[model samples]
Target: MTLVLDKLGLARNGEVHLDGVSASFERGSLTTVLGRTLAGKTTLLRAIAGLQPIDSGRMERQGCEFGLLPPWRRDVAMVYQQFINYPHLSVFDNVAFPLRQRGVPDAEARSRTETALGMVGLSDFRARAPTALSGGQQQRVALARALVRRADILLLDEPLVNLDYKLREQLREEFRGLLTSQSDGIVIYNTTEPAEAMMLGDRIVVMHHGRILQAGSPKEVFERPANVAVAGIVNDPPMTILHGRLEDGRVTFGNDVGFPAPKHMDELSRGSYRFGIRATEILPSETGGVIGRVEFSEVSGSETFVHVVTPLGEAVMQLEGVHHVLTGSQMRLSFRPERLFAFNADGEGELVRAPTTGEY
Candidate 1:
């Protein structure tokens, strides 16, 4: 079964919420809608759930018009960023609420609720109220509630965003197995974090400025981003874009920085191109050609992300372990030419050449 969206568009108060967005979602697959805030990820999910009305669009599920149905009539379930649960009901009752509303038999409802709670590791908390649970446990209850009904379509809008980092990581690790188990339904998970999107998605739908930017497998999108915009969105620290020129078999960034073009870019007839390299690819070296001054540094967990200003442009380097880099200190940094991504210097910055090496 397939859910297809055609030219979906929505606007409010002169602001475009969705700009001709279109994509196909297949059952049994999880598609992560990835984008920054106000990128219309939630708007897209709301449209699918019939909770948000679109000014122009056609939604078809299994060849039948789907947008015309009311929210209650759609066989869809949604979990929001917040830990939303029934305060008055026990965990078991909260999960069984939908089934009860549908007049499902008490025996079958209990069985389904029990199974859902167990799937989320919440079976032991079935007798407790949502208020008595931790943030993570409450979110799990929300998830179990969503799963208990076995809805045809499942939408999760940053469901783990409210939790602490450790809890988010813990829940995210378990989410893939739990979500993929719903192989008979269409699951769409929305997230602003590129890491979460890449980790959880079977396929990724990249969105920006209310438009569909790119849609493909996580590996495909990461290895070969559609354009500069996609490259910026998919990378955690954002890829460093340097305005450069390619001529005479050499790529040059500024007058002093030049290197022989990698083999992947040999076929390109380029005058000017934008070069991209990930932060992790840039390394500090004593004999490096690029001279940069440390602008600032951020230490995340065991890794340090150093921001530096160079003649070419500002760049970020991801170094393993903790390193205290002083601001305004001169540092030499280098990156392999073969790791660079080349893109057209004009228009949307279309990709000219991707790195030959698959590792990024």
Candidate 2:
């Protein structure tokens, strides 16, 4: 029910890829290893799959050691960014290949292959050659093949990257179910996309520079990032980091604008503080304290992000629906004090909530 990585470390090309990384992958839940490029997301997955050497670390699953085992000896399957399937093989053949190699009976392999294909919505394409399928369909076939193995652990490394926007959306809605279908197995996925991490990660392991930044539920890490690095990568438009002075629980910005300090930050000494707020938390207001000039606006489907230049710094405010605001126009951006996240110089921090009303 658990795959434990104890003091895991990996080095390559004279550089460290995973430095003392550690986390437990629990069965029945999707654990997402999230980070940007060169963050070791794939390296970590490969190490777990026994494809990459663990320079210094021990990996164990179900109370058994797997550090010295070969990849084929591990009960794991991986789907990659590239849809890797035999060009000459039919979808059904590809999905059945793993079972065939394992010497599974014909009837059992057929049943399991059909089941896996159906899980990926590829049952209809079973007879089609992999070369005839679209990229998304090919990826689905890869997923089906992996699922057919019924491995104890499933690894997906940016499996949706090659798909178009619409296809990505279509499969994202189905990925969660397919990945977690095996209640007794573990699904460990890796992605550089934070929004996707939040969408599918039941337990998100925030990683960067081959290190484990943080691990918690999606809401836990999103609501409270361990540092600026994790906070910077976890949001869609990214959190707006701002520098200001804190005096008597009040932070004053350079634009001569100030607001009550977060209640959670009451214990802090009056001094310089770095914090952040999500784009969606800030808004345009009539009496907003943080003022700025409209830089530009971007319309992303149902949401509109208004970029503004303020005395505090450049900030982005996310709003719903279309915006008629002209660029270069002045606008008042409101800061929701309670939504503020306080962090140290290193950017590790948590949300600061206001005191509950009528508590006294």
Candidate 3:
């Protein structure tokens, strides 16, 4: 089955929620809708489920218009960010509720409920109430409920966001297998996390300010972000954007930092350009030319993300292992000229050239 959205737009009280959003969803494929909070991820999903009205747009499923259909008449199931399961219902009954409501045979409901529970690793907890289960277990129950319906469209709106870090990671690993089992349905998962989106999605749709920024495979969007907004969204610490000039076979940032332009940029005309570099690409070195003062540092897992104020602009350096640097301390950094992503200096900041990949 194919679900196509054309020119989806929604505005409320003079504030736009979704602006001219358009995309196609295919069955057996999982699309992750990625954006920050209030980016309209939930609004889009609600519109698909017929819970929210659109100001303008058209939705077709297999050439049939379904945008105007009532929520119950649509073959859709949604899982929210919160653990939305019935406290009074046992895990088994909670999962079977949808099938029971549809008047499926008792025997068939039992079989489908058990299968869905088993897929989410909640079979052992089938007799337990939702209130008696852990957060992860409760979420599994919610997921099983959605899965049992086997709706034509499954929408998950940041369902794992409320769990703790370790639980989120564990469930994320399990979700890919569980969701993919619904091969006949179109799955759309929403998230604010770039890593989760990249890890779980077959295709990713990036949204910003209610607009679709870019949509493609994780690698395509990561390697060649459509614009500065996309680059900011896809990277964890966000790519460091530097306004620089490429002139006389040399690339210069600020007043003192300069290097010979890499061969990949040889074909381009020398002028003003915006350069982007990943935090991981910048390294601390004793002989490094670019010196910056550390503004702040964050240590996540074994990696340290150091924010620095350099002459060119603020840049973040992602370092392996934890290194404690005092705020205002001087740190010398270095990066290869070839690793920079070149973008047009125009207002839109379109990508001009991306660094060569796979060699490093």
In order of listing, the candidates' clash counts read 0, 4, 0
TM-score of 1: 0.97
Q: Cα RMSD to native, each candidate?
A: 1.4, 2.9, 1.3
Model 3 pairs in collision: none
Per-residue CA lDDT of model 2 for 134-203, tens digit only, reads 9888988998888888788899999989888987888788878877775458898888888788889888
- lDDT by residue for model 3 (218-324), tens: 99999999998889989998999999999999999877888898877898898999999999889888994699999999999999999999888999999899888
In candidate 1, list every pair of residues with a backbone clash. Answer: none
Q: Considering summed lDDT, which 10 consecutive residues are worst modelled in model 3?
A: 351-360
Inter-residue clash pairs, candidate 2: 226-348, 227-347, 227-348, 228-347
Model 1 per-residue lDDT tens digits across residues 1-360: 899999999999999999999999998999999999999999999999998999998999977899999999889999998878889999999999999999999999999888999988888999999999999889889988898888999999999887778878887888898887854799999999899999999999999999999999999999999999999999989999999998999999888888898888899996999999999889888884699999999999999999999999999999999999999999998877889999899999988799864544
- Report every candidate's CA lDDT: 0.92, 0.83, 0.91
Better of 1 and 2 by lDDT: 1
**Which of the numbered candidates is closest to the native, going by highest lDDT?**
1
Q: Would you give me the overall lDDT of model 3?
A: 0.91
What lDDT does candidate 3 reach at residue 155? Answer: 97
Off by over 4 Å in 2: 286-288, 291-296, 324-330, 346-360
